[model samples]
Target: MPHSLLWSLVLAVHIISIALWIGGIFYAVAILRPSLGLLDATQRTSIMLQTMSRFFKGLTHAIPTALISGWLLILHEGGFANAPWTVNAMQAFGIIMAGLFARLYFGPFQKVRRAIRPQASAFDSIRTQMLIIMALGFLAILSACLSHPFV
Candidate 1:
């Protein structure tokens, strides 16, 4: 109803979406991957598949929400031409991160799902892509911070 409240809600949605997507990736790479290494190949692939499947499904929803909320924030601040450089950079980074995630999901992840015994490379590929995405996410956050004037 109120202008400030609407902006706050949109910002909250954007932040939560980013956290869900990037934080999940961080968990998978930093936590789950290592935990899987302790298991045998069969167990590793099985658990990795199950975990990734759920993560990907959740991200399927998060990604769009993040994008849309980001756009809303941009519009609230003013359209792209009127927005600051940092906002534009964040938009670029967000799009790139989304693209990378889509590639990982459709490419190596598909092979992993179909293989009877997926190789370590498949998992490594996924991790590498996720790391890249996470880094981009950090950059986006940094850009958002930069847009704020420092006291």
Candidate 2:
């Protein structure tokens, strides 16, 4: 829509970054977490902690790329007022999602990782939070799709 090579590249990068971050969450929720039931508590905790550590590492890059590129795209279209409601919704959801992730990383995530024998309650909370993030991610995707005039 911006009709520029830069815009297209930025858009691609933004989409890819978000896909990696949220897609990882989905995998953890749907595939990884579910399959871990057979393992003992220690094994599950160790595996999940390791998985989350790497995932969060990737998020450190993805979040910034997605946010910055999104802002650039917004500015390209003549700033906030000129951008569609869907874009605004996406931005709001993205920011909230990032904030939520940070909170969990520093709070429950850290708590469980440092525990000698982490409680099941901690992982349950994290799972709930992940579900919320996943739902928000879906909402953002829906907002983006609805941006299409034909939609």
Off by over 4 Å in 1: none
Give TM per candidate. 0.96, 0.93
lDDT of 2 at 150: 82
Give per-residue CA lDDT, model 2, range 42-75, as digits (tens): 8998898899889888888998898999899899
Compose the digit string of candidate 1's lDDT tens values, residues 1-151: 9989989999999999999998998899999889888888889889999999999999999999999999998888878789889999999999999999889999989889999889888888888989999999999989999999989
RMSD (CA, Å), each prediction: 1.0, 2.2
Local distance difference test, each candidate: 0.92, 0.90
Which residue pairs show collisions in model 2? none
Pairs with steric clashes in candidate 1: none
Residue 21's lDDT in candidate 2: 77
